[model samples]
Each structure stands twice: as structure tokens, then as C-alpha cells.
Target: MQVSIVGSGYVGTTIAACFADLGHEVVNIDIDEDIVETINSGTPPIHEDGLPELVGKHAGQDGTGRLRATTDYDSIFATDATFLCLPTPQADDGSIDLSVMETGATQLGKTLEATEDWHTVVVKSTVIPGTTEDVITPILEEESEKTAGEHFGVGMNPEFLREGTAVHDFLNPDKIVLGADDDRALADMHDIFEPLVTKSDAPVVEPDTRTAEMIKYANNSFLAAKVSLINDIGNICKEYGIDAYEVADAIGLDDRISEQFLRSGVGWGGSCFGKDVAAISAAAREREYDPAMLRAAVEVNDRQPNRLLSLMDDHVDVSGERVAVLGLAFKPGTDDIRNSRAIPVIEGLQERNADIVAYDPVAAENMRERYPNISYASNPAAVLDGAAAALIVTDWEEITELDAEFDAMTTPVVIDGRRAIDRRDGIVYEGLTW
Candidate 1:
């Protein structure tokens, strides 16, 4: 299979490397020259586990040269399939802004205008239902001046890769979803994923294009809601002096309520959950349907940070005091801080007029772009020194072993959001939902 992926962001780069590793010739096309060069140099543009090794094995001068990156849209003409991995960022009104996808589709259509061989364009990016058939198909048809199913095929193959473990997830997926109306498009998708399916022995889900699109949104929205529900239950458990983890453990014994997404803390904040939930909610509203439970999930998640802040306030007066934030990334293993809970925690501390010192193992640089005013410490101990209280937002592996760092703090008050710390002898530890 010859695969061309548009956009060299996290999903794009990861998939391109994985495809090449699967013995498919892959070319990643992106507008960023630096990203293209980096991919061609056998280094991943983004930080992901096991990605560099795969990219290095198949790309670059020393490798097989099966995987390479280019900025030219014309490169798609040579590939049998092009995956549109562009970003669908949320607009101000909560609907997805598909301008990036639209532009990519237009350019792809123009590039395929002169080609006679049948090509398949797969929508790998998450979008609202009806977007593929209604929005993207028309743009491609208009630009190419060719019938979609006859001349070119379109398919919707939603990715189920999670950050921090994208390579493992891709290779060992739970299920493979193939969405297309036409037989040719469906066969092409199956052919592309045949290697993965045989290797992973994952279930294959064959749905219509719209259903596949909805599957991605529904999948993310449900996980977000589950986290919020656990957080809500965790909040109530805290009021009655109960350990939420214990409750989660017992409930997880039930076959229906699984153990995943049960750990409640400051709530989920990443590129997928918040944006997908918001987009789906907006889509539901557009059809004159109110998604009340989804809206409540957002409310519960939003209030969790304040609840953590209030717990901190109960122990110490942070006004005109120094506070250390232990983690900045949404979750450990990556430096992405799109909708991290630490943002609200920091903002709440700012409203209290506290001098903040933040620390993250790898996400400080990214968070610094959003908050350049806050002081960032190189290590956890540095952040704790002279600080009145500390809040743990992310559960980095290094944080779980910080037993002696509290001794340096002015006040050894710890409010753990992810339960990533222990209640040391000298430290007053307060778990968000314990």
C-alpha cells in the first residue's frame, strides 16, 4: 500500500511511521518544512513512545527509505491512498472549525485532477457525523471535477490512538473501524488495514461513513463523561470522608462498569475529550436536541479544579504567598497542555493573589507559552522550596516518589489532584477525592 498522510502533527506523524513499519510505503505531507525535514531525518516531530524507533527504522538515509515527508501536495498523486489527518479545532461557538480540512481536501482534489488511476481519500481526522458525506465529498468533487465513487473513493477511518502510547495502541488496537458507502472505498480501507488486523487480531467494525464519524465522537464523549461521572462520585465520597479509589475498585468489579477511566482527579483535559465533547454537543444542538448529561459532565469537570483549590485554601492562606504547582501537562508521558486542569488551578491561585511556581518534567516549555508570567522551576524540589503549599495536577512517574521534597517547603501542605503523592510524616497531604 502506498499511503500519503496530510498534516504532520501527532496523529499524522505517528500513523505514517506505523504504516511504514507495517511494510507500506508512506509519505507524510505537511506545510511545515521543519516537521517534514525532521520526519525525513528519522526523528518524530512530536514526542511519543516507540515512534522514533519506528520512524528511524523505515525513514532517513540509513533506513529502508519507505517512509519520507514532503511539503508538496502533488506527492499525493503517486500514493494509492491519502489520509486527511488535519486538525479540526473547536470554534468559539463550540462547533468544529473544518477550515483546515476543507483546504486540504481542496488541494488534494486539485492534485488528483489529472490522475486517471482510482485513488482513495480517507478522513482520518475526527469530525461530526455527516461531515464526510456532506462537507468533504463536495469539496473534493468540486476541485477535481470528477465523480467521487467512480473516479476517486472517499472513506472515513477514525483513529483510536491515545497519546503517550500511540504506537502501542496503533499496533495493538482493540478494533479497526472502516467507513465507506462505496465498495471500492471499503475494499481499499480493508486492504490498507489488512496487515494490522492480521497482526493484532483486532475486531473489524464496518459502518457507514456517518456512523464511523459519530463513533469517534461518541467514543471520546463517553470516556469524558465517564471521567466526569467518577469525579462527581469522587466529590461526594470526599464529603462523607470516603476513599474514592476504594469505591471505584468495588464498582469496577461489576462487568458493566469497567475499571478504565475510573480514577477521578482534576478531570480530563486533552485535545480529544474536551474538543470532541464540545463538538458533539454543538452538533446535537444543531439538530434541536439537547444533550443534558453531556453538558453536566462538562460542568462537573469544570468545578473539580476549584474544588482542589478550595481544599488548598482550607489548609493555608495563599494570599501574598508562594504556591508550587507540581505538574503542568494534562497527563503524564506527553508535553501537550491543550486543556490541562493545571490551567484552572493556576488561574484560581492567581485570583487568590498567590505567587505561583510551576513545574513539569517535560511540559513547562509548552505551558510557558500560555503563561509566561508564572515562575517555572526545573525540578519539583525547586518548586517546593519556600512555597507555602503545593498542588499536584499531573501524575508524572517521578512525582510518585517525592517523599522528602516536602521538607523544603515553607508549609508542607500538599493538595494532590491525581493522587500521585503519599501522605508523608511531616506533610499535610489532602487528596482531592480520598
Candidate 2:
């Protein structure tokens, strides 16, 4: 299969690499010349596990000629399918702002107008229900001046790739969803993922386009709400001086709950949960339905940072003192800080007039761009030296394995937001929810 991927961002770049690795010829289309050149030169533009090796293997520089990149939509005419991976950022009203998707659709439609060959367009980016049909299909039809099912097939194929393990997840998905009204589009989608399904033996789910779109929202919202529910229970456990993890462990034995998201820590902060929940909640309101559980979940997650800070406040006054912040990325195994819990922790430290030093194995530089004035340490030990207190935001392995670093702190008061530290002698340890 010859595949063309639009928008060489995280999802786009990752799937392109995965497809090419599965023996499909792939062409990545992007507006940025630097990104295009980087891909063609066999280098990945982003930081993800197993990405560099894939790019090095199939990106055409080594003469395998399985993968390449271009800046022109003209490349789409040559491929059997094009996956729309454009960004659908949150609007001011909490719905998805489709301006980027619209622009990409317009360009794609214009490029299709020049060719008579049949092509399938799959929406890979996350969007609310009715977006692909009510919003995007009309734009593509108007620009191309062609009937959708007859000339170009439209489909919705939601990606379930998690950050930090995107490649592994895509290659080994638990399910593959193929959503399309047109039979040809659905067939093409099956052809696109046949290699993966054969490789991983993952189940295939076929539904209408709208249901597929809602599936993504439903999946994310449930996990987000589950985390929030556990966090609430953990808060209660903390109030009663009970161990939350022990409670979580006991309840996890129930097969009904399954216990995937029972780790109640400083709450979830990443590209997916907050935006997807807000979008779904806002969409429900637009339809005149109130989503109470979703709203409560968001409220619980939003209050977690303040609770972690309050725990720190219980120990020592941080004003005019050095406070070590141990982790910046939203979660470990990646260097993304889009909605990291560390952001609010740092801001809280600033409000208390505490001088902050932070450390992460790969995310310190990224966080530095957002906060240039804070001191970034070369190692986790560097952040703890002579610090009055330390606040743990992300559960990076370096911070989790710290058994004696508390001795270096001026005040051995450690606030554990992610349960990254153990309770021991000679130091006061506080878990965010324990």
C-alpha cells in the first residue's frame, strides 16, 4: 500500500514510520521545510521511543526507499489513502477549533481535483462527533467539485496511541476501529491496517463514522473520570490516615473494575484528557444535556495541584528558600510538557516566593522554554542540594529511586505528588493522597 500522511506531527510521524516498517511505502506531507528535510534526511523531528530507529531504517536515506516526506499536497494524488492528522486545538469555548483541519481539507480537496483516481481520506486527528460528516465532508466536496462516495471516499479512523509508547501501542493495539459510510472507504481502511492486524492479531471494530468519533471521546473521558474518582477516594483516605494504594489494590481484584487507572496521584495532565473531556462536556451542553460526572471529574483533577501544594505548606514555610522540583514531563518515558503537573507546582512555588530548582532526564530543556528564569539542574541530585524542600510532580525513575538525597536538603521535608518517594528515617515524607 502507498500511504500519504498529512501533518507530520506526533501521530502523523509515528504512524508513517510504523506503516513503512510494515512494508508499505509512505510519504509524509507537512508545511514546514525543516521538518520535511529532517525526515528525508532520516532524522526524526520529535522525541519518542523507538522513533529514531524507525526513521533511520525506512526513511529512504539508506536506499530502502520505503519512506519519504514532501511539502506539497501534490504527493497525495499518487497514494491510495491519505490520513488527516492535522491539529484540532481547543477553541475558546472548549470545543475543537477546526480551522487547521479545514485548511488541510481545502488543500487536500484542491489537490484531488487535478486527478481522477479514487482516494480515501481518513480522519486520524481527534474531533467531536458530526465533525467529519457535518463539517469536513462539505468543505472537501465544495473545494474539489466532486461527489464524495463516487470520487473520493471519506472515513474516520481514530488513533489510540498513547504518548511515550506510541509506536508500541500502534503496532500492538487491542482494537482497530474502521468507520466509514462508504463501503470502498471502509475496505481501504481495512487494507491500510491489515498488516498491523495480522502482526498483532488485534480485534477490528467496524462502526459508523460518528460512533467512531464518539468512541475516542468515550474512551478518554472514562479513563479521565476513573482517575478523578480514584483521586477523590484517595483524598478521603488521606483525611482518614489510610493508605490509598492498599485500598486501590484490594478493589482492583474485582474483574468489573479491572484496575487500569487506579493509581491516584497528582492527577492526569497530558495532551488528551483535559482537552478531550472539556470538548465532550462542551459538546454535551451544546446539545442541551448536562454531563455531571464529567464535570465533577474535571473539578477533582483541577484541585489536585493545590492539594499537593497545601501538603508542602504543612511542612515548612518556603518563602525565600530553595525548593527542588523533581520532574517536569507530564509522565515519564517522554519529553512532553504541554500540560505537565509540574507547571502548576512551579507556579505555586513562585507564589510562595520560593527559589525553585527543577530536574528531568529529558524534559528540563523543554520546560526551560516555558520558564526561563528557573534554575534547571543537570541531575536530580543537583536540584536537592541545599534545598529547603522538594516537591515531586512526575514519577521519573531517578526521583523514585532516591533513598538518601534527602540528606542534602536544608529542610528534609519532601512532598510526594506521584508517590515517587518512600517513607524513611531522618526525613519527613508526605504523599499527596495516602
Candidate 3:
């Protein structure tokens, strides 16, 4: 299969490299010349675990000529299928802003007008239900001046790749969804994922386009709710002075309540969960339904950072003190700082007049954009030195190994948001919901 992916962002770049590695000739199209050049040069434009190696092997000058990138939308005519991997950023009121997706689809349709063979345009970006049929399909049809089923097929295939382990998740998925109304479009989707399905022995889900879109939202919303529910339970356990981890471990034995997302802590903060939950909630409200439970989940997530900071305040008055914030990325393994809990933690620290020093292995430069005046240390040890108190926001692997660094703190007061660190003898350590 010859596949072309538009918008060389995180999802677009990742899938293009993976597809080429899966024995398909792939081309990545992006408006950004730097991203196209980076992909063509065999270096990934984004940082993901195991992605650089895969991109280097399949694309670029030093590897197999199976993958390449271009800035021209006309290259879509050369491929059998094109996946719209553009970003659907959230609007101010929580509705999805589809301007990017619309623009990309129009450009793709205009390019496809030159091709005579039938091509499948798969919606790979996460969207609300009815977006593929109501929003994207009409634009593609108008721009191409051709009927959808006869000239070009439309499909909705949502990606379930996590940021940290996207490559592994792609190669070994639990399920593969192929959503299409037309038979040929469904077949094209199956063909694209055939190798992954066979290798991973993953179950294939065939549903309609709307159902597919709903699945992405429902899946993420459920996970977000689950975490909030656990955090709620963890908060109760903390009131009773019970160990949340111990309770989580015992409850995980039941098949009904699995251990995944059970580590009740400072709540989830990332691109997917908050955005998807808000979008679905807004969609439901538009339909005259109030999603009370989902809104409560959001409330719980919003309050977690404050609760962690309050615990820090219980031990020491951070005003006019040096505070060390460990970790800035949402999760370990990636540099993405969007919706990271560290943002609120830093804000809370600043409100108390605390001099902040933060450290993350890869996220410092990105976080610098958000708080330009705050000091960033090259390593965790540097942040701890001369600091009065420390707050652990992200569970980076290196943070768990710190033992001697705590001794350097002026007060040695520690607050663990993610339970990433173990309690030591000298420091006054507190877990947010232990």
C-alpha cells in the first residue's frame, strides 16, 4: 500500500514511520518545510521512544527508500490512500475546532481531483461523532467535484496510540478499528492494518463512521473518569489514614476492577483526556443533556494540584522559600508539557512567593516557554540544592533514584504528587493521597 499522511505532527509523523517499517511505501505531507526536511533527512521532527530509530531505518538518506516527505499536496495523487492526521484543537467553549481538519481535507480533495483511480481518505484524527460525515465529507466532495463512494472513499479509523509508548502500542495493539460505510473503503482500511493485525493477533472492530468517532471519545472519557474515581477513593482513604497503593493493589485482584489507571495521585493531565472529555461534555450539552459525572471528574482533576500544594503548605510555609519542582512533562518518556500537572504546581508555588527551580530531563526547554522567569536546572540534583522544599510532579525514572539530593535542601520537606519517590529517613515526606 502507498500511503500519504497530512500534517506531520505527533500522530502523523509516528504513523508514517511505522507504516514504512511495516513494508508500505509512505509519504508524509506537511505545510512546515522544517518537518518535511527533518523526515526526509531520516530524523524525526518530534521526540518519541523508539521513533527515531524506526524513522531512520525506513526513511532518510542512510536507510531504505521506503519513506519520504514533501510539502506539495499534489503528491496525494501518487498514493492509494491518504490519512488526515491534522490536529483538532479544542475551542474556548470546549467544542472541537475543526478548522485545521477542514483545511487539510479541502487541500487533499483538490489534489485528488487529478487522479482517476479511487482513493481512500481515512480520518485518523480524533473527532466528535458526525464530524466525518457532516463536516469533512461535504468539503472533500465540493473541492474534488466528485461523488464520494464512486470516485473517492471515506473512512474513519481512530488512533489509540499513547504518547510515551506509541511505537510499541502501534506494533502491538489490543484492538484495531476500521469504520466505513462503503465496502471498498473498509477493505482498504483492513489492507492497511493487515500486517499489524496478523502480527499482534489483535481483534478487528468494524463499525460505522459515527460509532468509530464515538469510540475514541468514549474510550478516553472512561479512562479519565476511572482515574478520577480512584483519586476520589484515594482522597477518602487519605482521610482515614489508609495507604492508597495498598488498597489499590488488593482491589486490582478482582477482574472487574483492574489495576490499570488505579494509582490514585495528582490526577491525569495530558492532551487527550482533558480535551476529549471537554469535547464530549460540550457535545452532550448541545444535545440538551447534562453530563454531571464527566463534569465532576473534571472538577476532581482540577482540584488535585491544589490538594498537593496544600499538603506542602501543611509542612512548611513556602513564602520566601526556595522550592524545587521535579518533573515537567505530563508523563515520563516524552517532552510534551501540555496540560501537565506541573503547570498548576508551579503556579501555586509562585502564588506563595516561592522561588521556583524546576527540572525535567527533556521538558525544561518547553516549560521555559510557559515560565520564562523561573529557574530551570539541568538535573534533579541541581534543582534540590539550596531549595527549602521539593514537589514531585512527574514520575520520571531518574527521580526515583534520588537519595543524597534531599540532604542538600534547606528544610528537606518533600511532597510527592505521583508517588514517584520513596520515603527516606532524614526528609519530612508526604504523599498527596497516601
Candidate 4:
């Protein structure tokens, strides 16, 4: 199968690389010349685990001449399938702005108009419901002057790859969902992903395009709900003098609950959860549905970063005090800081006039680049010197393994935002929502 991915971001890169590894010819398309050049030069555009090595191994290989990068619109017409992996950023009204998808669809439509061969365009980017048929299809049809499902079919195939382990998740997906009414489009998809399905029992669902588009939002919101629910429980436990970690452990033992995303922390911060939940709730409101619970989840998740600041104030006055922040990324194992809780936490402390020094194993460069005013030291210990308080925002393993003596601190205070640190004597230890 020859596929053209229309974005070179995290999802696009991983999708292109995975398909190429599976023996399919893939041309990853992007408008940026630097990104295209880096990919063509056998370098990864984004910093991800095992992605650089994977791209290095297959980027220029002739046998797997499968994987290539380009900025040309002519390549879109040559591929058997065009996967739209463009960004659908959140709008001011909290709804997903589909302008990027619209642009991609319009460009592909122009390519379709100029070409003679047929192709299937799959919406792999996370989009609002009905986008494939209601929004994108119309543009593609209007620009190309061709009927969908006959000349060039359209489908909704969302990607579900976690940032840290995206490559592994892409190859071994939980399921392969293809939403298309056109038989030829469905057949083309089955032929492309057949090897993956044949290797294991992967369910393939063929729902309406709207249903498929909604599934991505629903799935991410549900996971975000789980995180917020646990954090809410943790907050209740904090007020009632109980350990939220223990409560979660007990709840996780239940066969029905299943302990994924139950870890309580400063809250979820990434490109997906924040945007998806907000967009879904806003969309629901537009459709006359009162998504109170979903909105509450978003509120609780938003308040988590400030909760850490309040915890700091309750324990000690951070004004004019030296503080050491242990982590800067939204989570461990990735340098991505989009909507990270650390931002508010750092800003809140700074507003209190605290002298802050932060350290993150992988995210220091990004943190420094984003917040140059704040001091980003080389190591955790370097940031801890003469600090009155130590706060952990990201649950990086090295911070938990830190053997620094608490007696060396001016105040000996440690606040765990992710509950990563255990209780220790001689040091005043407090955890967020714990």
C-alpha cells in the first residue's frame, strides 16, 4: 500500500514510520521545509522514544523505500491512501478549530482534481464528530468537483498512540477502526492493515463516519475523567485525613475499576486531554447537551496545579524562600510541555516571590527555552542547594530515587505533586491530594 500522511507531527511521524515498517510505502507530507529536510535526511522531527532509531533505520532504505518525506502536493495524488494527521487546535469557544483539516482537505481536493487515479482520504487526526462527512467531504467535493465514495472515497481512522511509547502502540494497536460507507475504501483499508490484523485478533469496526470521529473524543475524555475522578478522590482524602494513594490502591483491586489513569497527581497536561475534553464539552453544549460532569472534570483538573501552591502556602510561607522544583515536563519520559501543570505551579510560586530552581532530566532544555527567567539547573541536587522547599511536579524516577539529605535544607520541606516520594523521618513530607 502507498500512503501519504499530511502532517509530520508526533502522530503523523509515528503513523508513517509504523506503516513503512509494516512494508507499506509511506510519503509523510508537511509544509515545513525544515521538517521535510530532517525526515529526508533520516532524522526524526519530534523527540520521541525509539522514533529517531526507527526513522534512522528505514528513512532512506531502498527495500523499505516505503518511508519518505516531502512538501509537494503532487505526492498526494499518487498515494493509494491519504491520511489527514493535521492539527485540530482548540478554538476560543472551546470547540475544535477544523481549519487545518479544511486546508488539508482542500489541498487534497485540488490534487484529486488534477490527477487521474483514485484514492481514499482517511481522517486520522482527532476531530469533532461529523467532520469527515459534514465538514471535510463537502470541501473536498466542492474543490474537486467529484462525488465522494465514487471518485475518491473518505474515511475516519483516528490514531491512538501515547507520546512516550507511540511507535510500539502504533504497530500493536488495540484495534483497527475504519469508518466508511464506500466498499472500495473499506477494502483498501483492509488490504493495507491486513497484516496487522492477521498477526492477531484485532477488531475492525465499520461505523458511520460521525460515530468513528466521536470515538476519539469519547475515549480521551473518558480517560481524562478517570484521572480527574481519582484526583477528586485524592482531594476528598486530603480533607478527611486519609491517604489517596491507599484509597486508589484499594479501588484498583476491584476487577471493574481497572487501574489505568488512576494515578493522582498535579493533573494531566498534554496535547490531547485538555483540548479534547474542552472541545467535546463545548460541542455537547452546542448540541443542547449539558455536560456538567465533563465540565467539572475539566475544572478539577485545571485546579490541581493551584492546589499544589495552596499546599505549599499551608505548610510554609514561600515568599522570599528558596524553592527547588524537581520536574518540569507534563509527565515522565517525554519532553513535551504542552499545557503542563508545571507552568502554573512555577508561575504561582514566582508570584509569591519565591526564589525557584527547577530540574527535569529530559525537559530542562524545553523548560529553559520556554521560561528563561526561571533558573534551570543541571541536576536535582544542584537545584536543591540552600532551598527552603522541594516540590515534585512530574513523577520522574530519579526524583523518587533521590538520596539527598533533608537536614541540608534550610526548612526541610518536600511536597510531592505526583505522590512519587514515600514518607521519610526528619523531613516534613506532604503530597498533593494525599
User: TM per model?
Assistant: 0.99, 0.99, 0.99, 0.96
Model 1, runs deviating above 4 Å: none
lDDT of each: 0.93, 0.93, 0.93, 0.86
lDDT measured at residue 263 in model 2 versus the true structure, 0 to 100: 92
Model 3, 1-434: lDDT tens per residue?
99999978889988999999899999999999988898899999888999999989988889898889999988888888999999999999999999999999988888877888899999999999999999899998999898888898999999998988989988888888999979999999999999989889999999999999999999999999999999999999999999999999999989999989999999898799999999999999999999999999999999999999999999999898999999999999899999999999999999999999999999999999989999999999999999989999999989988989899999999999988888879999999888
Q: What TM-score would candidate 2 get against the native? A: 0.99
**Which candidate model has the greater TM-score, 2 or 3?**
3
lDDT string for model 2 (14-65, tens) is: 9999999999999999999999999999988888899999998998559377
User: Which residue pairs clash within candidate 2?
Assistant: none
The better candidate by lDDT, 1 or 2, is 1
Cand. 1 TM to true fold: 0.99
Which residue segments of model 4 deviate by more than 4 Å? 61-63, 405-408
| Residue range 1-434, candidate 1, lDDT tens digits | 99999988889999999999889999999999999899889898888889989989998898899999999998888889999999999999899999999999999989889899999999999999999999999999999999999999999999988889999999999999999989999999999999999999999999999999999998998999999999999999999999999999999999899999999999999899999999999999999999999999999999999999999999999999999999898888888998999999999999999999999999999999999999999998899999899999998988878888889989999999998987668999999998
lDDT of 2 at 235: 98
**lDDT at position 162, candidate 2:** 86
Residue 433 displacement (Å), model 1: 0.4
Per-residue lDDT tens digits for candidate 4, residues 259-283, read: 7778888899989999999998998
The 10-residue segment of model 2 with minimum total lDDT is 58-67
